[model samples]
Structure formats: structure tokens, C-alpha cells
Target: MEDEKNRTGPLMIALQYNDLFDLDSISASTNTEDALPKGRAVAFVKAVQTVNERLVEQNKSESLLFEVILIAKECSEEIKMKIVESVKYYGLEIGKFFFFKKEELINTLQSNKVKLFLSTDRDDVCEALHTGIPAALLYEQSDDHVLSQLKVIFSGDVIGFSEDSLDSLSDFGFSETQIETLKAAKICMKEFAVLIGQMKRRFGQENSPLCICVLTAWGSTNVCVSALKTLREWGLDVDEAFCLAGAPCSPILAVIKPHIIWDGGLHNMRDLSAHS
Candidate 1:
């Protein structure tokens, strides 16, 4: 009943939980009307726990720099209540909730100072990214794989950078078409890089539940090397860097068992839910 718009404190991670589940499927899967944890919410719950535990152990709990917020588009009261109940059932303690029209999403996120916006809807994620906030389209977790750590993979396209001041990536053996692809991806990755850097500083890279990686089809290309170098200069280096050199990364992704994979194409977020 209280106004949640004015709620402010530590920066937050906003989750658009509406698209995270197939409501019809969930209803069919369960016999009761009570909201049940299904889909990626299960994996997300564990991931959040892992992060919280790491923060507590490192004695960084007090600062509480990042909190979780839940956002959903306006729906019937019945559906809204179901969402609230389901979130609580999953043990994802939300600091605030926003039920707004789709058009208000960016304003809501920016007003709340959300550092990252995550959603199963690709359009929603892309919309958020255009607002200059780091956003990722998450696939549904197909299996109930209990995650001990929140493994993350960033497509090399998103992490790589070719400064205009320097020559284009094409000068470094990349084709003119490939260079065009890089240009399109530049802005989103720049903002995302900063967000990841903050996480590394807060959580401490070694022995942490947050595993960051870069997996690209670029293989061992010169531009790929430059990408890592640029990330290092930004004071952030991925824990693992894989250059598949045009190989289908599905196999590699299955082995890594990442909870979230950020692709430059954005919409191409694979269904990695099958593997842990």
C-alpha cells in the first residue's frame, strides 16, 4: 500500500520475474494455486544465496552495496499476488517491488539506481541496455541444477574493444564485416565491463562464488588478445577466457555450466538450463 518508488539506498539488481516462467506451464506442473519455484528462479535463488554468503564471509555484509529488487509489468491483482507469493516461496528477498507499465521500465530502473537489469524477455533486456544500464537476457533453467557458484560467461564480442583513436579491429586481421559487428556491440559492453569490475572489487576474485568468464568464437585472434588486454587495463580480467575460433560454443558452454551467459547478439542467449 505504501509508495515504493521513493525507496532508495544501496544500488540494486532488478529482476523482471514475470517472463522468467511460463505461467501456463507452471500451473500445469503444479496441482495447487500457490506459487511454486520453477524455471530459472531456482538457479537464481541459489546464485543469490551464494553471493550473499560470500559477502558475509568477507565481512562486507554491512556495506550492503547491492540489493535485489523485483519488477513486473502491471497485471491482474490475482497474477500480481501470485508473483509476490512465488518470489517469497523461492526465498529471493526483494528489497522493493515495482509493478508498472512496460513503457515505464527504464524510468523505474534509473530512478531506483539499478546497476544491472535481468529478464527472460530479450526485448525487455535490450530496452534496458539502451538506457545505459547493464542488462542481460537470461534463459530459463531447464533442469533443477543446484548451483554452488554463480558462473557467468560474457561473449567475446561484448568484452572486446577497438578504440577509434587506434585503428579499427579490421586492421588487426578482422574482416570489414566483423568490424561492423564490433561497432554495434561496443556501447553495451562498455557499461557491462564497469559493472563486472565493481563486482570483482566488492567480492574479491579468489575463492568467490561469482565466476566471470569470456568465451568467444574469435578463437585466438589478435583482436581477442586485444580484448583481454583492454579488460585488464580497465582493472578487470575474466577468471577464464576461451577463444573457440568459430567452433560452436554450445559444447564449451555445457562444460562451463554457467548460470548466465551474455551474448553480443543479446537475443541468442542459449538454453544452458539443461546443464548445471
Candidate 2:
């Protein structure tokens, strides 16, 4: 993956396993481990089911390739469904995940500080692009300039405007309603992932109870509203709540239902990851 050593630039830590296929073997031995919803797991694993056949042509013996394929597929399923699901239940969209052709993505993290994969399309890359310092790569390339790949870059910081900068809003073709929604989210949220880093540095790696408060947007989605209600019931000790979305609405954030929603929320989380 991109150069993870330098903290200044966009660094992606792409974890590729060595010669051990032990995890893969462990997967086939059990069926009770489930952490993600079935749909996500199926979609994730089915992605490369088409390519497994090609493994036969890798010039490796059939027995070796078959074992590798089995292990790979089993590990893939365990991660998307079981691992991600478990973390989601814990109120953290946080975990280690698999990525095909992870080396290419790591290459971007080197000097670019931003991972822009110019080559090697991996099925799992889509998961990688959606998070971690606004990373992305080409899906289908084209000659169009305005609609180029660089568009994926986090240029929102470049405008030096409020979250609702009309010009930036215009770039995405978001309607007036969409712009308002994002603003409400920002107001209620006091910190982002970047802020979380600061806190960790300030406090060090220690665990302590936190006092949280949420401000609701005027037109908050029902899910958001329901979530707040749920938080209160769960003894979150919410200090304050406000309306920023415009009207009384809440979001269905429970879909990513986590046991302990982070103080910063999962709005800018990376993707389906897991622990060892």
C-alpha cells in the first residue's frame, strides 16, 4: 500500500498476508461466526467468484491452487459477514478488511500522501476508496476532463468556505435540500476523525467514560431521532440535543447499528475492516 511510514502524507496501510493460509483453513472449519448482514457478505464474496476459475491457470498445481482458492474464499466470507458484522454491532464501523491488489493502493500512499491507483483493479478496492483520507481510484476511465478521476480528491477543503459553500455544492449537483442536510450534521458534530487523532494525542491511550451531547437538525431523519432516543435510553447521558437538519427528522443510522456509537460518529469511517 501507500507509504504508511510518513504520517504527513496520505498513507494507506495495506495489509497483505505472507505465506500462511492458516486463517483461510480456520474459516471452513466453522459456520457459527457471523458479524455482518447476509446481503453485504454475499455481495462481497460473490465479487470474485468469477475469478476463482482463473486460479487454475496460474501454473501452480491443481491441489495447491484449490487449497489457496478455498482458503481465500473462506477468509473473504469471514471478513465481510462475520468480522464486519461483529464490529458494526459494537457501534464501530472499524475492523481490518481484505483488499485485492492491495499493493497498488499502497503505492499511492508513498509520496502522494494520497492513494490514487493508476493500475490494478481489485474487487475489494471499492471498500478501500470510500474511506481513509478521501481515497479513490479509477473504476472506468474516460477522456473527459471535468469528470476526471481527480474529482475523487477531497477538494472540499480547498474552497475555504462553510460546509454549505454554494459553489462546492453546485459541483455535486446536490439540490438545496441536500445542502441543508449536511449543514445540520456538521453543527451537531463537534469533531471529525482528524479531531479524534488530536484527542488521542492529548489524552494518550487511556480508556475513560465520556460525556456526550447531540444537537438535532430541524429536519433530522427519523432514524437520527430514533437513534437519539435509543441513545438516551441506553444511558448515553446526552448533555444536549439540537435541531439542525431543518425540521424534525431522524436518520436510520441503525442500519450500521453499532453498540457504542463513537463520539465523532461513523460519518467519515473507512470501511468494512476486522481484527485478527
Candidate 3:
């Protein structure tokens, strides 16, 4: 069946592995044994439905793969069963859902060829990234946004730009000399870039359901220009680019309401999540 789908066309085929969401991202944190999927559960369901619908509209037979992985220190059978039931109730169609220990996560992810891993927990995200997985810390959304359109925002630092340059840019104080030095630094493609490239390849750049945006802290300075040029040099062009120049991103984020935001540090995610 997979082979048949691949034969349809380049854009019509499914990605080998797409998104993997941690249980915490979909569920509410609680002390109870049966913590059913909550918070972003509905949004996740909508995202899957939208992606499948878009694929069908383009005359594709395969659906975008969405997996829900649970990594627990100790998860009983009853709790696991309850989680399965809750996922069904929420109508979140998962391609592969399983529970694993912390030690088993890297191997599991490798064997499955998971492209992008997302979790609301900082530690889980950090672990995945540390193991060389394309991972991002997802923030919980309470407001209504366009779930059909999966909007993802990435910081310049997350894209593997110069750290020192980004720090200066965020401070709203960067001279031409600093900007030139940043541009001189050899910036290689990071895991996040690889994920973006995969998406672009799977759906074609113009037809992809993803609305990729770059929300850089450089604002509108020359440093911002250099950073953007670096992104292009790395073969990435996002749908939207924001040069905030050290301003609060809450207002801009509230307007865009991206489904996920990727940054270089957990602190960045925490700060954005707090303000968003």
C-alpha cells in the first residue's frame, strides 16, 4: 500500500515519518491515574483532519503520519488503556502510538524514523534534541486559531545562526562589524532545518499546508538582514519573517497564533509560552 501511494506522484506521496507528539502535549497534568487527553487534544485532531483533507484534495491516497508517543517512568496498564480510549474519544488518528522508558526513547525514535518530535515538557524536548532528534517544545494554546493551517515559528537562533550575533541582536545593539563577523561564521544546517526541508519536499514549497514563519529577535537592523541572508544561504525561505528588534513577541504571537514555536533554549520557549 505504501509503495502504491508513492507511485502516484512526488507530492502525492506521504512522508516516511512526520510528527510525533508526546502525551504531555495533549493531556492536562494531573495527579490522577486516568489523565485523559486535554488542552491541545482538539487542536491535534483538527490538525490531522486538515492535513488529510488537504492531501485528498490534491488527489492523494495517503494521509500525513501523526504519532503520539508516551515516555513514562512507570505507566500502568489501566492508565495506558484510559489514554487509548481518550485518544479515540478525541478523534485523534495516530499512525503509531506506544509507551517507552527514557532509555528506550532514542532507539524507538531512530527505528521509526520520526521526523519531528514535539512536547510541552522541556525535559522531553531537550532529551530528544540532545539525542539528535528534530525536537521542539510546544506551548499549550487556549484560544481559537486556524488549526487547518499548521503555522510554525522558528527563532533565528533555533535555525543555527551565530549565538553571539543573536545575543547582540536581541540586546538591540549590534554594529556592522558584529554583523559581518556573524555572516563570516560557517552556519551549517541543523535538525530544525532538516525538518523544514523534508516538509518542503513532501508537499512542494508552494503547496504545503505548513505556514512556516521566522520570528527573529533582531528586529529591523542590519543584523536582521544578515541573519535572513544566512537563512537563505542555508536554503530556507519562510512564509513570513518578523524582525522584532528586541520587542516583546507576545503581541505578534497572539496575532499569528502559531501551533508551534522552536528556539535554541528551553528558556526561550518558557518565556514565549508565558507571554503568549
Backbone clash total for model 1 is 1
User: Per-prediction TM-score, please?
Assistant: 0.76, 0.20, 0.64
lDDT of 2 by residue, 1-276 (tens): 122223332212222221111133444445655333222222112212222233234323322110111111224544545544543553332223443443544333333332222211233333333233222212222112122001111111111124534335544454554344334333322222232222223222222111233433322244345545544333333333443344322342222111112211122322111100
What is candidate 1's lDDT per residue for 197-273, written digit by digit as tens? Answer: 55566665566777878876643455467667777766566789887766676788778778666764434322221
Q: Is 1 or 3 the stronger prediction by TM-score?
A: 1
Clashes of each: 1, 44, 2
Model 1 worst lDDT run, 10 consecutive residues: 267-276
Residue 186 displacement in candidate 1 (angstroms)? 4.5
Worst 10 residues of 2 by lDDT: 148-157
User: Which lDDT tens digits does candidate 3 get at residues 1-276?
Assistant: 123334322221111111222344444455455446355434644664576566666655543333444333346676667666665765666544556665776677677666565666666665665556565546566425436567777765334345553454434444444443333322213434533444444576675776777776633445455556766665456778887766787899878877766653433232321110
User: Considering every candidate listed, which one attains the maximal lDDT?
Assistant: 1
Backbone clashes (count) for model 2? 44
Model with the higher lDDT, candidate 1 or 2: 1
